[model samples]
Target: MAPKFGTSGLRGLVTELTADLITDYTRAFLEACPTGGTVHVGWDLRPSSPAISEMVIAAIRAAGIAAVREGALPTPALALSAMEAGHAAIMVTGSHIPADRNGLKFYVPGGEITKEDEREILMRLGQDWEIALRPGALTEGTQSAENYIARYVSGFGTDALAGMRIGIYEHSSVARDILIATVQQLGAQPVPLARSDTFIPVDTEAVDPATRTRLATWCAEHALDALISTDGDADRPMVTDGTGQIVPGDVLGALTAQALGAQILCTPISSNTMIDAMPEFARIERTKIGSPFVIAAMESALLADPQAKVVGFEPNGGFLLGFTAQGPAGPIAPLATRDCLLPILAPLTAAARAGISLSELVERLPARFTAADRLAEIPTDRSAALIEALASDPAQCAGFFDTLGKAEEMDRTDGLRLRFASGEIVHLRPSGNAPECRCYAEADSPERARALVEIHLGKLRDRLG
Candidate 1:
């Protein structure tokens, strides 16, 4: 596999993600599992995922473990099911990667496997590559997909979404069904737009402007309240309000926490400049820019204060915790994974409670223009060199200006972030999961943000070239 363990798990082109590799990885994971624990296997809508799911089931069964197959569900659904069953999960999904690639994300009883854990699994599998003999049953299990959908629907009582209209862009996401079902169950009119049989890869951070214009046109015609879409696996969310403007993930994440009256909020630093705007809400903590990091902090937040309510991460936008405290839904537990359904439902609930449209809720927040772009095929060493070059000589960095009569500060939390004097910031971070260097910038004006990003990228490209 090509760099199996990135920020999440093993992912590669479908051809490179062979059946043998999956079987072996599943076997290795099962071996590492706590004894006698059930293994939940699930997959997304990619054409090759079902076959990979089957391979995992065979491997898990061969290891003498019970297999609860959650066919064609979101990655978070599978994880939640596994956690509910008090077992582990293996999700076969490429997430937001192009249709050409596919992979597996494994979650254990505690959380996702760390880089060290993956290395051990890979080493163990390498030692026993030739031990492929027994085949196991692929028996179908009871449909637990409904129960998964019900969690979101039931959490937000029907009265909250009784009169809203949500437009779902069902572009090859496993959460399409749950998104529609939850809206319907909550008495909202769900209009599914752009339902595709073939995969439509949506880069959450890089939502195209053409798509946004198209959605706006549809909302105007249909008078829809909001537009929502999930990543390939339904773990990440993309939401747009009535104006057809795609709301930044961090803004939606914060609103979700606000709706729940959460005491504690955990998120990454790639969020909007407005996250610090919520001073009235409970404590807010920041983690490294990844779901696993957010999840790890969430675990500690919950542990330290039993009453602490934790919301999940938003790669593009954040996810809300449906059940933080012990509720009738059997202690609505904190999921260590992202669920797109929460962003859609929680904001709708909040909007309903406020008697306003999604656009209004977003308008009430501070104004900031956030944009992200990526330069593919960038080498890791080159990216490091660029950061090092900038850090070593900040005064020599051209095209970056000082404004607002203040000084600039540079932060290297997960990546290199330069905060300008004008509150405008630029970020250059190598994607841990891909061979690309992503550039993000946020400013008071859209043109300013775009211009700042372009200037920095132009300089970096020349250096890398």
Candidate 2:
């Protein structure tokens, strides 16, 4: 079966994510865009990345365009470089999914492609992938990593985090070295922890129990000020406070917005509800979950209020700065893509300035907590059927949430998000990147939010079984 595009990119099983497939899609993407000149390609630390990237680079050259290789780097780094050079880019990554899976993210001359662009590429794609062809030696891309670090270095200044001691859990992330270097450049004492060559899928949004325990252990062992890490491609940030406890991504988004003093903020419906009540942000827009949706909404917001400070973030801690934000160090250039660095720096800086720990800063926010998990081995059709059953009939919706509480209201933004009479939320959606159904819950306390996720996931499991 042909791999399909997800929220941010194309993801599928490694068996089906073949070189021929990559080559075929790369050719189709080039055919779909007239602005193609020099294409920039990068990949993650996955074992399959180099081969997939080679296939894509060869296809770019085969299409009569120059393929400037950016080598192994963070997804956002490649995107930042591509945007600066006005060149299209492709990233070989699987994000936070398991190692058995791999995927690709494409960027046009401007940034991530929109839904229309995805449709165009899909329409252009052929039924069968081409036979493997000899890959041509490509030219090395310019100093994109350096340029990306420079953005933060200039924005936050040297040693801005002078008094902070951060631990970087480098468990085979592509940006392991780059992240450590950036922290050092910013004058923060960084402890490199959990360095591994094997690719590890570290989901920031729904962290695993084993990883959580490890983080806590690391924090206790080293007395860290914070622990920072990212997903496979290093676009989504997973941050831990001094005690090695995590701060939910949506809460981090709020703090980052506060730090940026953003006038217009765009997020997804699945984000924390505090955004709705936040008065500091004059304009708050919630889009369907996905960077593309948020990016488009940001475009509309900027067009309406050109001079207003605009920014977008997701519950995954992937931030997009619609405008260059001025900070103590300097003015940072806008990287209107899912970026991990900005979310990390903006919040850490805010806490440092206030002389508070990261956890303390998080607690100061309105009491709203979120927990997420997925029911694995569930097909997309099955997951959609579940939502359709509830959405098509009010009784189904009411009965589905009846055990927990009355379904006070229902929201179908990107999925089925039902608000309970007990001031709790349960959102269920099919995983875009994997064969699973994701469930999210939010409540007044962390324990309650976690319990809701566990309860609802059990419900889904029983129904599917």
Candidate 3:
């Protein structure tokens, strides 16, 4: 069988997500995506992503709809371009997945795909139905790659980083171009370090210590102010300070909140507690751990206060700016979803504004380290049964919660999240995009948080068995 739609989109081994499968998904998605207007296609740097993107574009064309190609832009860049062009867009990226695998993220005219919408696309694929020819033939619209670069460059509004040296660890990801472009736009010099032929996938959830050390050393030797890079598709950011230490995403989020003076901050519960600590008066909205869930909360916050300054999710270090308290059109709606460029530019701007180093600005934020671990590929059926059984026996669940520190609260927006005292929390849920039972914990110490995770996961696994 071809890949089925997960929480985000359809992802599978490259061998499985073939041209034919892309065609089927595209046809079904185009037919079902609430706003059936013109469609656009964008892709990442994976060796196969280009071929798959071409196949996707061809399929869109074959369906008698116009298709615009935005080659090699970050996933969010493509989404923004599509939103601005007033068309639905599909981003071809496995985003931090291994080179052997790939996936697709699609957006409708209004916004990102909801769970129900994805299920509908799968349902359409199951049916042996064909789409009727639209009145027009497919047009390969002009590429907007340069335009996106220019937009990001201009958005920064300064040569604040002029003549500063920046090193981009081009670890075989799609972000290399924008990293260089953004640096150049700020009138700074960009040095490319360590280019590899084989794909070097970096997991945002678990960064390598070796990579961290390498970045730190590079910055010191070159006297560079910062190191900027991104995940496979560049939707998320990974940054380093002048000392070359890799800055975690949660740390970046806090700085962004400070920079934007975002009175209303929205982030996943997996985010650092510092998020809640910073902006003491600002209302922090914590949702289940996913960009979609974060986006939903972002929209709600805007609805409540039109003048409310807002930003949204994931400590993978992506910062989205300009979301006003108002609805979609509220100041930053046209540029909705997480973008890698914001984190890079915001820190630079904040440093310039404060006359301090990037490292110093980061230090100003409350100090915290967040660690996440996942028990991968648990049987889907077993996971469901475990959760159901736990829910059925409230007393047992409560007892477990007591061990964690009496559950002041339980949240099931996306999955079961048990919040404890001591500022420690455990999020136990099946991956919306994978077969894993995932756990995210944040505390004063990485060891304690991870230990808490082990205790919960072991119990769950044992009970399931």
Candidate 4:
């Protein structure tokens, strides 16, 4: 399929992301957004990303916009730099997808582009445009990476994680080095593990069983207080406690917000329902899945109460700071884009401050468990059809979920989220980044949550077969 805009970015098979297509999208983004004269560009470690970055830079220059090449770095790093400079940015990354696929993420001066911006970009595609008199100047910069590291280290303080042993899972994540540096700077003994030259699509939301086993082994071997990692481009974080049990992303969000003393919070509907039980947040808004939606909700929250400390996060552990909040060292600036560092550092620091292990800190929260998995390579159309069938027919929906419990309520914010009579939740949605059917389940216990996801996804697989 041709590259198209999804919930996060424009994505497609690497082969289909030709030079012409990349240039068209790049130019279209420039035309649609208010990009200043200079635009920052960055890429992930994926082999295809370098070439894609070159194409994007060429397109920017051709459009008479100066391009500052930030080299290989995390998406949030590039975004932070661009936002700081009051300019726009383009990141060449597929973000947790296989290396065979690649994509582009665009940011305006303010933050990630909204749905309206995506529509404008699409409308401008293939349209006629005037060429610049000369190619805009191209330059190199490492300031983005530097700024990202400092954002965490300065805010959290050097001793925030003193005496903690943290394992850095360097599995081809562009943020690998930065993670280690930031953790070490915060006084954690960083144990770097499993650095991979080849790109690994580490999905933080759905940690496969094998990767979980590996994380446990690493934590035990290194006597780690916690293990931290990110997705390919590092916008999403994967963090595990001492026992290598991955913390639910929404739970991590809540802890981070609490650490930051946030009063207002925004999250996607797909996130764990436990967020509602947190009494610390004065207001919580649930939007349709996607950072743009969460960002919009955050903007609304800020507008509603300018003094409120606002934050947003995704189920994948990507946190967004919507207001400047006081940190131990200083005041942290707002970064409206999806970020991985804050979530990783805040929770670790909170655990350290409480003189407790990461797992213990998690146990303080409500007893809610969430599990997610996906059936890959299923056509998006097929997944959508299945959802439509269940949504439109109550009998079919009830029958489909009979093995679990009767469907008492349904949420169609982004997909089909069904609440059973027994208080379990089974949500089915098509993956925004790939041809897959994603299943998310929540229960009072981890075992029940995992079983719900497994049983539902297995049923989907059989039906598709």
The TM-score of candidate 1 is 0.90
Per-model CA lDDT versus the true structure: 0.74, 0.86, 0.72, 0.90
Tens digits of per-residue lDDT, candidate 4, 116-186, equal: 99999999999766779998999998677888999988898999999999999998999999999999899
lDDT of 4: 0.90
Ranking by TM-score: 4, 2, 1, 3
Greater lDDT among 2 and 4 belongs to 4
Which of the numbered candidates is closest to the native, going by highest TM-score?
4
Which stretches in model 1 have alpha-carbon errors above 4 Å?
Answer: 33-36, 114-116, 119-125, 129-138, 318-332, 399-407, 454-465
Q: Which structure among the candidates has the greatest lDDT? A: 4
Name the 10 consecutive residues with the lowest summed lDDT in model 1: 398-407
Candidate 3 versus truth, CA RMSD in Å, comes to 4.1
TM-score of each: 0.90, 0.96, 0.85, 0.99
Residue 452 C-alpha lDDT in model 4: 91
TM-score of the candidate numbered 2?
A: 0.96
Candidate 2 residues lying further than 4 Å off, grouped into runs, are 34-36, 127-137
The full ranking of all candidates by lDDT, starting with the best, is 4, 2, 1, 3
lDDT for each residue of candidate 3 in 1-465, tens digit (9 for 90 to 100): 236577567887899987778888988888888535677788877888889998888777767777877777777777777777778888888787677788899888766776668778888884554555663245554546566666655555547577578889888767787788778877788988887777777766656667878988899888898888888888888888888876778777777666655777788776787776665536888877777677777778778776667787577776655453221111223356667877776777678667788888877777666666555657666676666655567787777666665666677765676666776777777766665676667677657866776787677666654
Worst 10 residues of 3 by lDDT: 325-334
Range of the 10 consecutive residues with the lowest summed lDDT in candidate 4: 1-10
Clashing pairs in 1: 249-317, 314-317, 314-318
